[model samples]
Target chain A: MSPSPEILTPERILEATEDVLRRYGPTKATVVDVARALGVSHGSVYRHFRTKAALREAVTARWLGRTEELLGELSEEPAKTAEEKLRQWLAVLFEAKRHKAGDDPELFATYGVLIQEASGVVDEHLLVLIGQLAAIIGEGVRSGQFAARDPLAAARAVFDATARFHDPVYAPQWERPEIDDEFRAVCELLLRGLRA
Target chain B: MSPSPEILTPERILEATEDVLRRYGPTKATVVDVARALGVSHGSVYRHFRTKAALREAVTARWLGRTEELLGELSEEPAKTAEEKLRQWLAVLFEAKRHKAGDDPELFATYGVLIQEASGVVDEHLLVLIGQLAAIIGEGVRSGQFAARDPLAAARAVFDATARFHDPVYAPQWERPEIDDEFRAVCELLLRGLRA
Candidate 1:
């Protein structure tokens, strides 16, 4: 009925873990629950991810990886100016975070706890996001559209400055009617600061 | 004696409550403990503050009010240009947060929980802080040093933009060696954005 133990893969294990985490929430979810959902042994799950912590971290990574891929593709659009791309990037980030927070609040909250536990995974994810931000700032600098001595530093500043819109800590404020206005004001000011 | 019932004022009760919270934390601290600390009865404490929740909110407001007063004074410096005052205001706010988080970590953590439990107090605190920021920006607008049409809106934008430096959620990151540089970069960009 279920896939053979020999055919079990890391991707399949991670998929099962995500659903298990959402259903049970992060605190109550266990490796055995994931195994039960998959119709396999916990030992088989451990074969793919050595420990429960490791398995949880892998699930967090996979979830974050999807966002990274989507943003990475969005940054590659050649038709838009760098400023346009940067604005779009910020808006998309805020929307993604808002949708995640609003669409499935239970899973969003579960990941919030998981994020605190898997700091290494989160740190790596932040670095990738910053890298993507830096690339767009660098493009603007090269095109004489933005003026910054260090694109990386400017990128970090921009990212930190906009944290209110995307930071999970402020997710409750995301649904406020004035949130879009606040987001736009921050963006306008930052773009003016960056313009050559 | 430890002040008669007639003299057991709200201020004295709040002072005792702050000490008690620091010692036992927000979750464990009780009105009975505050009363004991002040050599008074629980009924006496309740007379000054009707409920445990009310007492904790008062303590939180008193703690936040001190910083608000300090920043309000700094923003009123008549001799300094608005830009200098703005830069100094941001730096001082960061320093106050760093000191609070570092000086007595136990107390800092106790208040962090207390703050969450007392959101109304925090919201009022934010409004006062934003008003102080708007006063400085209003001065800048008059002197032709900044370019915002609405000082209140700009004040909110500035406050939200630099949240990473002063927000309690980011208190742990304040001590990073590179945090100072990051602070400077964000301030520089923001000041540039505000310049006329």
Candidate 2:
């Protein structure tokens, strides 16, 4: 085993917790296992997280944040037209989620349970995503590319409209050959709707 | 204790099974409870259902069929324009689901579990709903009302777009005060998208 780090940080604890969760799944995973993985006392882990629930919530937030960070860059690209940015933004989001659900299904399943336990985190993540969409839509409206009086509402509608392409519950269907065609059709419809 | 029915039918068994599920939930609900509720022998219930899984599946189909029957009427209305029909159809679906979720939450929760266990039933129900949407969309396309090349694809997109208003996972949000406004805004956007 690698030597325990001299510093025990929340990030270290969270990283270890993810490993533990993957090893044990959600129901059986424990703070003690995370501590063991980190080669630290449970007290040290608790010192950073305060509680196991807090630790799990943080991990979930971290997982969701990665998607936000990736999409945030696309949303902020002033060089690209808002319409193009919006299209790429959605495509990227769908691909990221598909990869997470496909490349590491065990961890994906673990996060599914953790997400239920961390609804507040998930809610916050959703708001962040909607905010990203709203920003892109607001740009479109200001540029006279879209005809939305309420950019935020329009953004939400777009989000909901494309949910089958990105939502975790529909992950099982994402791998189907027809999903790409479906995604393109949805994007085309939304783009048409947005055209002023 | 009412007198047991002289003859047991699959319909009766399904009805009793729904009551049992409502009372005990999916996990604790059993074929025996259905039999007890109907004041009939377990053998009588089994003889009609063939197995407990079949009984639960039938109950799920029965629950879903109620919504189908309600929406089926809207899809068949010839006098209404396809756009108007599409608008009303989505509105009615959202209302129907919201009522089912709100009117009897216990039964709704019971059916949520039953649905997962009866995915084939759920899949068939989805196809029926999408088919209805496709027919309306095809009508729209033929009449020069909508611009979709693939009515079925457009129908699926519309379904996914409006999911938050009807999907069970988002049922909790359906009761929020602003949901009507949200639903209207989404419908407006989609209606615009379909405009030729």
**What is each model's TM-score for chain A?**
0.96, 0.94
Local accuracy of candidate 1 as per-residue lDDT tens digits, A17-116: 9989888999899999999988898999988887899999988998899999989999998889999999999999999999999999999999899899
TM-score of each prediction? 0.97, 0.93
- Give the 10-residue window scoring lowest on summed lDDT in candidate 1 chain A: A1-10
Which residue pairs in candidate 1 collide?
none
Q: Candidate 1: lDDT of B47?
A: 85
CAPRI-style class, candidate 1: high
TM-score, predicted candidate 1 vs. hidden true structure:
0.97
Stretches > 4 Å off in candidate 1: A1-6, B1-6
Best-fitting candidate, scored by DockQ: 1
Off by over 4 Å in 2: A1-5, B1-5
* Residue B182 in candidate 2, Cα distance off native in Å: 1.9
**Candidate 1 chain B lowest-lDDT run of ten:** B1-10
Chain B TM-score, candidates in order = 0.95, 0.93
User: CA lDDT of B54 in candidate 2?
Assistant: 85
lDDT score at residue A8, model 1, on the 0-100 scale: 77
